[model samples]
Target: MALKLLSALDAAKIQLYHFKAIIIAGMGLFTDAYDLFCIPPIMKLIGRIYYLDHHNSDKCSVMPKETQYKTTPTAVVSTLVSIALLGTAVGQLVFGRLGDRAGRRRVYGLSLGMMVLSSLACGFSICKTRNCVLVSLGFFRFLLGVGIRGDYPLSATIMSEFANKKTRGAFIAAVFSMQGLGILASSIVTMVVCRIFAVSSNEPKSETPDEADLAWRVILMMGAVPAALTYYWRMMMPETARYTALVEQNVVQAAIDMKKVLDVPMSEIAEDSPIRLKPPVLPHPSYPLLSKRFLRRHGVDLFCCAATWFLVDVVFYSSNLLQSQIYHRFIKDNNDVNGYKLAFKVARFQAILAISSTIPGYWVTVYFIDRIGRVKIQMLGFLFMALVYFAIGIPYKYY
Candidate 1:
């Protein structure tokens, strides 16, 4: 039998509200993916605009020694890329707790606001020197990362709480699927911006400082659009019934809120009834996460989740953040192209790869995750990844 407090949520029929919740949650992820993937192309553009002469001038022996090759250090570029990740880690820990304490709806809008403001800040990063510019950009991006990371826990929790159990998995999957769209959007926007600047410039083969500077800013600032668009809807959303009924122990309010959401009428109960009188309380015994009982009960599961996530992120971020480097190594004949043109080429390549591979992979997961089960899919994915890595590595090493 379903728990009285949860029966309404579990038994409720899937409706338009479910789709709205998915879109609201998914748009946050879309913004997150767009902001994150957009950086690599911009990073490459930065190198070309600010450091190409220093890094590349030595390669061509005939080049003049006096050539101004102002280069931002590799460490600085890496720092700019990695600092946001660090902020994300912190935000997840901090906001996950905050969401529980303050309620989801109240804290949800804060993250979106931070994302919008910080994205604009990142686009407008300005300073007298290359190092200063990098520092400014890094700081804003770190803040942006914090906001983006908060969405993960908040969105998942909200969607799950709002969904009927029969279709819960699908709703959550749909929300996460928006991330692929965000990635596609980033690539498309970057390609379009770069192409426009490249074609319009009279000296398409030579770097134009003005065009290069404007292109990156435009890309970075565009991340704010999706987040800004969704903010009002997020704010207007009611607190999830799960949070109110279970967390707050306010059964009456929970029923009222859910009635409106599900478009179903709720029966009125006596004020003196047990459901109306129960105070907010935690379902589990009050114990710290590190308590012996918790460790004994769930330690292994927790450890596995943490370890797997760590490994996955390490591989995922490294591959994505360094994709431009891989592209440079494979395509070395772009000397005649200007920095903006090169950036366009990189963006187009990434977009093609995303459309052909990454985006499809997300949908495949969405379709099969419920039918095949998470464990089997995860195991198969890991096995495939391992085999592919070995095949590539062994050949390259021996040859």
Candidate 2:
């Protein structure tokens, strides 16, 4: 009988320094998760501060007078709320290119810087100045999205390149998984800040600046701190061996860099095999999008991944946004008139939904992604999502 071990110590050599790179790279991803969560909470605060009621109110009356005259409802607030996701979609395209061309580390550094600046801007910007608020908020959110855009490819590539194949799966997935933790932490912070502000003002979470500004400012400021600290840390980290090899085409330098991360002697790094260089592939200037053979083959997969992300976000966002509506319509007892309890229930529900709905769904990907492949899982997700949406649209009558 043959003794076939899953991971041989000799075959699967991983040094301590590689773990360091993973930690540095993972920080960028953590920031991405934190920023994404932070945006929604800020939007919630903005809605409350401005008294953006779904029902009739002073805040809703703030829409354009022309629209008001026509009785056609304006969706300015909703559009503002969606700016981050829209920005993220654009960022994904722009920063993906930037990462490929300018190098991941450079683009990653730029992304983190953008995130820090955007978060600070978001915290301090004057909401009272409508145009200023609109422009700044949109610009900053877009910049933040650009940063987020780079994080996915950069972090994943860094981790994969630095790690030995034996541990690559675990390390890469672990880094991505931390995003969930950052999300949970951001939510807790937002809820706490909102609670404090709501209590201090003795106003409902539904109620303007009195109930909203302080909490959102604090949360946005909190989101910036991680980016700023991680920026310094990531700055100190070295670029991956794979990226270095591709750029310089120096096999010896690439091996040395790999050994540096592996913390093993030069000879022990690749079992005494001689390092050989290969010619780099140069692309033509006029290549069309579909002209790239490799990209064309996997283009559908890429589109499916993007569509899955879009759908997941839509469900996640809609589920979260509807919490207040659910509470106001069905859960809250109008006779109680105690806003604190109402807010508490809403917070509790959101916490539950965040835990039950979002976190598990993320893990389901981690577990089954390898088994089913990205396209199959994404297709399944989209199919189920469509079914759920259709079911919701049935709209049975209720009192």
Candidate 3:
């Protein structure tokens, strides 16, 4: 079996296959971000639908002079919004290990399937009682979160495996940048649905509750479309050469896969035919992460990277939690809306933020990450984040 797999990967030129890999992984990220962020714009509609104050005269009203509407309890709102995150944590841990043991390609499709099915389930969770709907929505969303989180490690691992050393970071960053597009798409989808269902701003807010009801479900299920579309390509993708050769120790199969991936002749990839070898070469020894040998070899790197990532994600998701609050505070002092107006406003705001910040931020990382090198770019990112935090009087410690 072939021994020159790593060298071949290192030496290969960028090809259509590489870009296709990027798109496949990027679509997963797109689905992940869409599912994660879609809840915020539609929260008010959820409240209007489920948290109505029946005794109030203007209960869930859609009049021209509509003044206020009931909001769900803060704790209930918090639970509904954050349950997906809890599911994601569990999914990441479970799927991360499973991807290693069972196989990346196999686990990849399962995670995506989980996303598609759970999204539809969340949408289909219409119920006669509020409690019934909340319970079903929360549970299905948790499952959706589990599926959404798997996109990260799987996409990153697959992209890294497919990329050459020189362009690896850029490829992975490109995958991540797709999240920006997903977020923007979520906002745009909300806007379009609301426009279709909602009356004009100058008109009475008397559009039937059924319209808003149908709107949120449509938004939630839209995630399933892209995710389901991506799954076919994801399953069509070959298992990575690195995993097959290095983990499974099937060097001959890895060679053939690489030949297809690299779209090069076997002779050009390696000196001899892989089948001519009597038996596969054993994979290099790997260390258990908890072992002393492994720690000594990788401890500092692991700690630094993990800590850095933890801090970033903490800030990132914290912002997500705070985003709705921030918008409501600035836009309307958290005033409740009896119609779809608030959702439409929030959607517009989200689209604006995507255009001004999120899209540019991710695309900049994609374009500059390789040229600048990872560590330096990371340092710059931290510097910018720190400056923003400091300006806002939030204390942060760098790892």
Candidate 4:
């Protein structure tokens, strides 16, 4: 009664290939998070290095004199941080449909390649003036964002199609959990690199031009490492059997591919028999996404998902990208600290925060998602987040 590919995939037992697929798809998500979130801790340092005056260190009455050091305007910093989101918005639209049309495996490696190349290019961004440097960095990061955003739909679709029904949710959750690890890795790597530069220098609080510039570059470029490592494996991966059978309508090829991936013999698949291939007695009309029937069926669900995701991301990205600014207010006010050293401190703090809260929350979700059910967990998460935000807001003035 069911399609050969779907039946095979649903019936297959958990095996090595399942785990391999998770890794292959998950690494892209890992790189995505690392590259996206890595900018926060370093944003202040970027401002200090390029926008602020290096020569002045005068103390101020209300706040640190470093306010005077700012040569780069706040708008420029906001632009550098937000430009990637613009790129991602465009990429999601372009790549989402492209994957379905062009084939997932074919476009998968391209996204990874873009991420690797753009990460490196972002690190190496250079120009004569600060404005030019910012412009170059923004362009590369926009490309990087394009690459990272492509991974979202591709990986989710690939994982979902390839996964067995029994453990499909878990498998997809496992893939997404890698994003938390990626975030943690970015912080840890930045902390280590900053520490190395911090200890090597004789003058800890004084900015060394070479080290300050190199540190941010290294942090940005480190994102490319995981993406590059996974590229070969991703290219070798076969297209999902669902896409092969349903989308491409090649039953035999789909069976063969599933055999290789699932490690099951072709003889085991009774679903592929000729009788099962007979046309349905009554075929349903295929409706476009905006058609009345489609809208009636899925409109509310789609709107809720889109709205919820937008709200969550608005909070998540804003909090993450502006974390350094938040922490800076509480930290010791010192104008003497070099940009690199300050960046190091911020990176370490963020790393601790990620390790303590962010990474653990992800693993918990991965383990409990199937058991607790997604809707319930999501509701609970939203509730907790709301409560936390309310508490913070109520006490905002005290800080």
Please give each candidate's TM-score.
0.89, 0.74, 0.89, 0.89
Per-model lDDT: 0.78, 0.62, 0.80, 0.78
Query: Any idea what lDDT model 2 has?
Result: 0.62
Model 1, position 94: C-alpha lDDT score = 80
- The parts of candidate 1 lying over 4 Å away from their true place are 55-73, 265-274, 277-285, 329-333, 396-399
* True lDDT of residue 161, candidate 2: 66
Task: Give lDDT tens digits, candidate 4, residues 1-399.
Answer: 336557768988999999999998999988998998888656756766675443453433444443455333557767888888888887888888889778899888888899999999998897536678788999998998898888877998899998888788889989988887887888888878778877786753544344567788889999989999878888887788888777666566677678777887677654635643432344345987779989899999999999998998998888777676665565432556666666666667777777887778777877888888989888987898899789877877787
Which digits, one per residue and each the tens of the lDDT, describe model 3 over residues 47-163? 666664444546445633344444566777788789999999999999998999878999999999999999999988867477888899999999999998887799999999989
Q: List model 2 lDDT by residue over 25-77, tens digit each.
A: 77777777777765544544454334323454454457632221111123654
- Lowest summed lDDT across 10 adjacent residues in model 4 is found at 275-284
Give the C-alpha miss distance for residue 37 in model 1, angstroms. Answer: 0.8
Candidate 4: lDDT of 289?
A: 72
RMSD of each predicted structure: 3.3, 6.6, 4.3, 4.1
lDDT of 1 by residue, 48-162 (tens): 6666555565664766333434334678768888999988998898888899988898777888898999999999897636778788999999999999888778988899899
Worst window of 10 by summed lDDT in candidate 1: 265-274
lDDT for position 182 in model 3: 90
Task: Estimate the TM-score for candidate 4.
Answer: 0.89
